[model samples]
Target: MLISMKNRLIATLAILAVLGLATGLIFPGKHAKAETGKAVSPGSRMEAPAKLEDTAGLTAFVDGMMEEYMNRLQIPGAVISVVKDSRIILAKGYGSSNLEQALPVDPATSMFRIASTTKLFTWTAVMQLVEQGRIDLDTDINTYLKSVKIPATYPEPVTMRHLMTHTAGFEEGGVGYQITTDPAELPGSISETLNKHMLARIRPPGVMSSYSNYGATLAGMIVEDVSGIPYNDYIQKYIFDPLDMKYSTVVEPLPKSFIPYQVVGYNSETGSFIPGTPTFEGGFRPAGSATVSAVDMAHFMIAHLQNGKYGEQQLLKPATAERMHSTAFQFDKRLPGVALGFAEKRVNGVTLISHGGSDPMFNTEFYLAPAKQLGIFLSYNGGQGSEAASNLLQAFFNRYYPAPEVEQPEFAASAESVQKYAGSYQFTRHNSSDIDKFFNFFAQLNVSIAGNKLSLGSGSEQQLYREISPNLFQLEGGTDQIGFRTDESGKVTHMLLDMAPDMPLERTPLLDQSKFWLIVVGVLAVLFIAALLGPILFNRRFKAMTLAEKRAVRLSAGTAGWALLSFITLFMVVMSMDTMQKFTSISPLLSLSLGMPILLAGLTLALLVSTIQVWRNKYWTAIRRVHYTLVTLSAVVLMIFFYHWNLLGWQFG
Candidate 1:
C-alpha cells in the first residue's frame, strides 16, 4: 500500500491543485463585474456621479470606474491619463497616495515607479543612436560594451535588433538585484551587475522573444559606452529634456528636489505603505528604473504619437520612430506579436502598441493607438494594482472600439480527445539554474477541458478559452489566444501563454501539484511518532526481539526520521525572504541551513544499508518487507530531491 515517488508527486500536485481550486487561490475564475453605484463611507471620498453625460462623459465615467475598482480591490491610489485625437482627453488621479498620511495622488506632479516601461525609453535611446549611425541594430552587442562581454554561445551573435524585439535569446536574468525596497542593499555599478549576472543563453539569438530585462540593461550599457555619458544622464539629456519630461528620471538614488513629489508605494498584503526608500534595480535601472508622473508620461507618449516630433524636439527621425513601432518579430503569424521595443496588442480589430511595468509595490501600463491617435497611461501604487490595471485596459478598449461582427469558425473535435489536453502546465520563462529552478514547481497551472472549450484554474476565477484553430484557442468573447504545439506523434508539448508567448510552457506530467514528496515526509513523520510510542505502548514486544533486530528497527526508523527533519530545515531556509541575496552571505544561520541537506543524504545511505540487510536476511513477513521497501524507495526519492535542488552539498551560491 506504499506509493511510487513519481505517482506520489503527481498525486500530491493534483491534490494541491484541487485544494487550490477549492480555496480559490491558483487559477481563480473571472473577476466580479464593477458596480459604479456601490455605496461607501464619506471618509473614503469615492462616490459616483448621479448622472452620466454624453459630452466629455469619459472623465466622470472613468472616475467612477477607478473608484469602484479601487474600493473593491483595496488599491490605495492610481493615476490614469488618456490622449485621444492628439488632445488630452483626461489626466486624473484618484484615492489616497499614502493611506497613513492621507495624501491624495496628483496626476500632474506625483511620480510613481514606472518599472519595466523604462525599457521603452531605453529602446528609444538605442534607436536615437541607430539614427545617427552611432549604433547598428544588426551588429553584435559586444562591439559597443566596454566593461562586460556576453559569452557567445551561438554562431549568431546577439544584436541590437534582437534586444529591441526581446528576441535576443538570453535566458531570463535578474534574481537578487532586480528590485528591492532597501537602499543599503543596492547592487554595485550597472556594468558590474550585468557582468556578474550574465545568464546562460539557452536559445539562439533572434530565435524567439523572452522579454529579457538583462538584454535591455545591456543595451543601456552600450549607450553609456558609446555616448561617454552615464546611462541616466544620456536619457535625461536626449529623451527627457527634448520631450520636456521635467518630472521623469531613471537616476538611481533619486535626487532630493524630486523627493517631495515621489509617491510612496503601498503593500496590499501587509496593508501598509512602503516608505520612500531609494531602492535601485542595479543594472536593471536601464530596464525598469524610471519614475514619472502621468502628466510627464503623457508628454513622452505625445512624442511617440507624433512620430518623433514634439514641436522641433526630434528625439528620433520620423522614419526611425516608425521602424521602432513596426513588427520586429512575429511568433504566430495570425497574432500580433513583438514590435521592436513595443508589443503589438490587437483588441476589437484595432492594433495597439503597448508595454507594461511592475515592481513589488507598483503596476504601470502604457498603450498607444496610432490610427486613433490615442495613448493611455496608468499607474497604481499597490499589489492590487495588477488586477486594476488589467481591468482598466480591458474596459477602455471595450468602451471605445468594440469588436466588429464576425462569424465564429467551428472547430471539429470530440470531447474525449480534447480532454487529453487538460493537465498542469509549467512556464518555460523560468530560471534554468540556481535555487530558483526549484521555485518553478510552484508555478504549475491546472487546466480543465469541457467539450472543445478550455478553462484555466477552477470555479469563479477560471477564464474560458475556445479553439479558434486546431491547436490554437482564444478567450471566449476576447481577443487573446494561446497556441499549442504538438510533437511528431501528435502529442501536445507546449502551450504558449500569450502574455509572454515566447516563454515556453510544457504540460506537466503530474496532473496537479499534490507534491508526493510532502506525502513521503508525512509518512516519515508517522513512522517517527510510532517509534517514539513503542517504548511506552509496546515495551514487552521490544524486549522479546533480538539485539540485532532491535538495532535494525532503530536504524530504519531513525534514518527516515532524520531525512524528514533535515528536509524541513533546508526547505525553510530556501524559502526565506531574500534567500537569493542571502545565498552568498556565509552567515552561520545560512551555513547550518545549507548543511542540513548533506545530513539528509547521509541518513538516506544509512536507510539504504538497512534495506539491503533486510532483503538478505528475509527478516520479516511479506507485509513488513513491502513496508521497508517503500520506505527505502521514499528515502531515495528524498535524496534525489535534495540533489535536484542543489542542496546535496553547499552549492547554494
Candidate 2:
C-alpha cells in the first residue's frame, strides 16, 4: 500500500508541478549471458512488416504503440518478446540503451534486471530437487536448514509449499538498507544474510500470504544445502545450463563478460533521465536481482509452455511442470489462484500464469499461457516504466484475446452487511513489531458503500466494485474480484483481493483510522504558522502578557513548533534519498534526529498542564484561552500519533 500510494503521489505531484502547484505535499544487479539459443545478434533492428500478415500486423501495431509510449513516458529503453508454439514470434527492442551514446537496444543481447522474476528460477530449482526425491514440498523447512532456524512461533512449521506460494506467514522485510551500490557491503553467504535479516512470522504457516522475500531466499538456501552447491552455481548447473540460457544468471555484481550488454537505468526526476546507482540487493538476491536478455527470456518461456522441454532436453517431467502450475492457494473459489511460484492473473478470459519483477529503476512483466502455447515478456528501463508495461500488456491482451460473453450474475447485498464491510483496512503485509508499522498512517485502504456498489477510496478516484454475491464483489465492469471474510457474527474481518488470499487485509478500528488525528494535524499546521506571526499581528496584546501568560504562550508555541520542524525534517530527508536507500541511510543521524520527536512528546505534557493554568488565570480573554487550549490539545494528539506509531522511540524495532 505504501508503494502504490507513493507512485500515485509521484504522478499527482508531477502533474501538479505542470500547473505550478509544487510547494506542498509530503510525498514521497549483474549477470552473465547464455551461450545457446541465439536468434538475433546485438544491434539488429526490427524487420520491416512483410505483407502485413497477422504476425506482421501485430509487429507493426505494437512497435508503433511502444515507440509512442516510450517517448511520452521518458523511458530509456524497452524490450518485448513473444513466443508461440515453441517458436519466437517476436523479440524486438525499442529506444536507446546508452542515452549518452544513442546506442539502440539489442533485443538479442541487451540485459535488463528482471527483479522478482528471479523467483521463478529459484522455484524451478526447488522443483528439480522435488523431482529427485531430495526435498519434500510439504515438509518442515527447518529440517533442511543447517545454518539458521526459524523461531518456533507456531505449531505448524513452514513448508516449501508455503514458501513457494508466499503463505509462509513471514512479515515483509528488507526495507531502507537492503539494496546498495557496493558489493563489498553484502554478506558473504546467502545463509548469513537470511539469518541476520530473518523476519518475524506473525501468523501460522499456510494461513496467510504476505509475499515474503525472506521466505524465497530461505528456499534458495535449502536448494544450496540439499544440492551441496552454492545457490547461484546450483541454478547455473541445473536450470541455466540445461535450458542453455547462456546470457542469463542469478549472480550479483554481474560477471565482467556480461557488463558490456548491461543497460543503465534512469531515475525520472526534473523531467529528465538521471543515471542512478547500480543496486545490489545484498542478501535479498534470490527474491529478485537477475539479469537476462529478451531472447534468452523467450527461450525460458518456450520451455515452460512446451511442458518443460527445450528442444531435446527436458528440465522437468511434463507432470512436474503441470504440478508447478497447479493452484496452491486461491483467495476465493471463484477467483484466480496462485500456482506455486507463479501468480495467476486473468486477462480477457485468458489465464496468465505470470510473475513481475521490479527494482528502483527497471521493471519486468512475463506471462505464459500453457494451453495456448503463448508467452510474452517485457522489460523496461526507467522509474515509471512499470506503468507503461502495464498499459502495453492490457492493450496487447485486449487486442488479441477478447473476453468471452458471460452473463452477469445478479445478487443483492443487504445495506447492513455492506456497511459492516465498509471501513479502513490495514494491509497484512506490514511490519507489525517494528517502527515500520508507522507506515500504516498513509498505507490504509478506505472502503465506502455507495448503494449496492463497494467503492475503494473516496470521491472521483474511487474504484466501484459491484456486489456479485454475498460478500463477493467484482471490480465494476471488470473481471477481477474481491472477497470479504466474516466471522459468525457477520462482521467483516478481512478482505481478499485477486489471487493473494494469504495477504488479506484486516479491518482497522475507528481509533486506528481516526479522523480526529487528521483534524489535529490541520489545526496544528495553523497554530504553527500563527505562532511565527502572533506577536506582530497583535503587538499591543503581546506587550500586556503577564509573566505566567507569557510562559504559557512560550510553552504552547515551543511544543507545536518543535513537532512541525521534526516532521518537516524527517519528510525532506527521506524524500530526497533514492527510495531504496531512504530507510537504512538514516542510521548515522538516527540517534540525534530521533531526539526531536522525544522532546516534542515530553513538551506535549508540559503544554497540557500550562493550558490548565491558563484557564485558571484571569488576565487572558475567553477567546485567547480557548485558542490556546485547542492548540495544546492538538499538540497532545500529535504526540500520541507519533507515539502510537512507535515514531517517538529511537529504536528501529
Candidate 3:
C-alpha cells in the first residue's frame, strides 16, 4: 500500500501545513542521518551466500525484527511467511488478534485483509483468459464488456495493457463508495455500479502512470465477461481450488466457514487500541477485498516464483507467466518500472518484484526475488502496519543481499540549470476536477537548491539528491534515483522517482502553488478586517455620509467583508475533520458550505456596481473611493480562488 501511503501522506501534510500557518508556525525541520555508502572489500565481506538457505537463521531474524516493530509501533497482531525454492521456509503469526478476547493469531487459520494485494489475483485471472486466447492484452477493453463501456475520450483506445500498468489515464476517485461497514450499501452488480459512477478519462491511454482503482475494477469486469462467470466465483473456482487455499476468499461479509477465523482489525492512533468495524469494498471488491491467511499467501507466492505452477497444477502457461513477470512499461529506463501487474524495484543490488496493500486498519507487503527463488509475505493489523512492513522489508533486504558499493559518478550543473528544477510538484495520482482536489492544495512537494545538490520535501521527511547525469539525480548515499522530464523548450515538466513508478509528479505552475493562494488569503483578511473596523471606529464620518453613499458603503464593506470571512472560517472547520471521515462521505455541514461560494459571487457582483457608483457620484474623499475599489477587487480574487479549487459548485460527484 505504498501508493495509499503516498496519497494519505499528501493529504495529511496539507492539513498540517494549514494548521501550522494559522499558528504562525510552519513545518519543524529535523535533519536525518546521511546513509553511508562505504565500500566493503570482497575479502572483508561475509562468505554466506546471498540467498535464503538456512531456515533457522531466517526465523531468528524475522522473530527479532517483528518483536521490535510490534513494541515500537504498537501493532496488535501480524503474520509473516517466507518461501524459498518452492518450499515454505517459515509461516508464523504473532501477538493478539482480538485484544478484548485475548485471541492469538493462527497462521494456518486466521484470515487478514490484504487490501490492494488482491489486485494480483484479478490480474492473474486476466492472464488466464489471455492464455486461452479469450482476451487480448492490446485490444480495446470495451470489446470484452457487456454492461459498462469505456468512453472514447482519446483517439487511442484503452487496452488491457494500459489497465495492467495503470496507464489508462483515468482520474482517481471512489470516496463515498469505496468502502462501507453496511451490507445494504453493497452494489447489486459490478457493471451496474460502474455504469452509475465511472471516472472521467483525463489523459490519453498509455501516456503516463497514475494508480487508479476504477481501472483495476474494469479489468475485473472484463474477466467476468470473458469467462461468463461472476468475479468472486471465478477466483474461488480457478485459483483457490487449484492451490488448495482453504482460508482465503475475496467475498465480503466472509463466507460462513471463514467467519470464525477472521481477525479483528484495530486502530492505535490515540495511544490505545480500539477495535475497528468490519468494512467491505462493495463493487470495488475486486480492486482490494481479499481476506487471506499467511500460509495461503505463501502458496500464491510459491506458484508465481515457480512460474505459475503449483505441483501438478499449472495456473498459467510457462510462457505466459514469464511475460507477466517481465517489464511491460516504464517512464524512465534508469528508474525501476512496472511489470504486468507487479511494481519492479532494485534493492541491495537485487531486483525484487513486489506489491503493497493498505486498508484503514490492515497493511500487507508481498515480495518475490525471481533470481534467488525467494518470496516473502507480511501482514499486520493496526494503524502503524504500513510503517512496520516498510521497516521489515528494508532490514530483510540489507541482511540477505547486501549491496556492493561503487564509485560515485561526478557531475556538476550550472546554478541556472539547478534553479530551473526548483518548484512545487504534485503527484499525478490525484483528483483534478472535483472537490477532492481541494486536498491537493496542501500535498505539493517544494524542491529547492541546497548548495550544489537539490532538496526535496520539507521538515523531517526531506531528502537530498545530487546530480549524477543530465536531469538524473541520485540520492546522496542511497540507490534511489529521480529523473526529470523537460519539454521541447527544455523546461522541466515532470519528475519520476525510482521507488514510485505508479505515480509521477508534475511540475506545478506558480498560480497553483499553495503559497500564492495563502498570500492572497492573507491580503484579503487584512482588508476585510479593516473594512469592518473602519465604520465602527469612525462613527461620526459614517453618519455624515449621504443616503446613496451609505448604501454603497454597506454593500462594498459591510456585506462583502463579513461574507468572505464567514466562508473562510467554515472552510477551516471542514478541513479539520478526521481524514477518513472526509473521504467516506460528504457531511451535511460541508454540503452547506459548498453553497457559500455562490452567495459570495452574487455579493461580489453587487459590490462591483457599488464601486463604480461611488466613483461616478464623488460620494466621499478620493482616498475613501479608492479604498472601496480595492475592496471590490479583493472580492473578485476570492471568487477566482473558489472557482479554481472547485468550490464554486457541488463538485463531490
For model 3, residues 1-653, the per-residue Cα lDDT tens digits are 12232334434443221111011111111111113322212111234434467777777778887787687778999999989999898999999778888989988889998878888899999999999999999999999999999999899999999998989998866544556777777644889768877888998989888877788889999999999999999999999889889999999878888888899998885688999877777787778889999999899988998989998889888899899989888888887778888888776678878877776678788888999898988888885665566556656665676567688798987677788888888777777777767766776777898877888755545568889998899878766678898889999999987766776889877767888889888898777777767777888998998888778877777656656665676578466755455645677877777787888888889898888888888878899888888888888888888888878888874
Per-residue lDDT tens digits for candidate 1, residues 250-274, read: 8766789888888887655555455
* Model 2 C-alpha lDDT per residue in residues 1-653, reported as the tens digit of each score: 12333245335223111111111111110000011111121211233312323787778867866876677667889999999899998889998777877888888899888877888899998998998999999999888998979888999999999998888898764444456677777545788887776788888988765676778889988998998998889888988888778789878888999988888888888888888777776666777768999998998898888888999989888888999988888767777767888877666577778877666678787888887788988888885565566556555654565455577788877666578778888666666655555544555667888886887655444557888888888766656578887889878888877633344678876656646467767777887768646766887887798878778877877777787887777545434544555433445454466677888878888987888788776548898788887877777777777777566765453
Best-to-worst lDDT order? 3, 2, 1
**Which candidate has the top score in lDDT?**
3
Error of 3 at 280 (Å): 1.7
Q: Please give the CA lDDT of all the candidate structures.
A: 0.68, 0.71, 0.77
Report RMSD for candidate 3.
Answer: 5.1
**TM-score for candidate 3:** 0.92
Error of 3 at 559 (Å): 3.6
- Model 2 bad stretches (over 4 Å): 1-54, 414-417, 457-462, 499-503, 511-516, 523-553, 575-578, 587-592, 605-636
Model 3 pairs whose backbones collide: 1-356, 1-357
Candidate with the larger TM-score of 1 and 3? 3
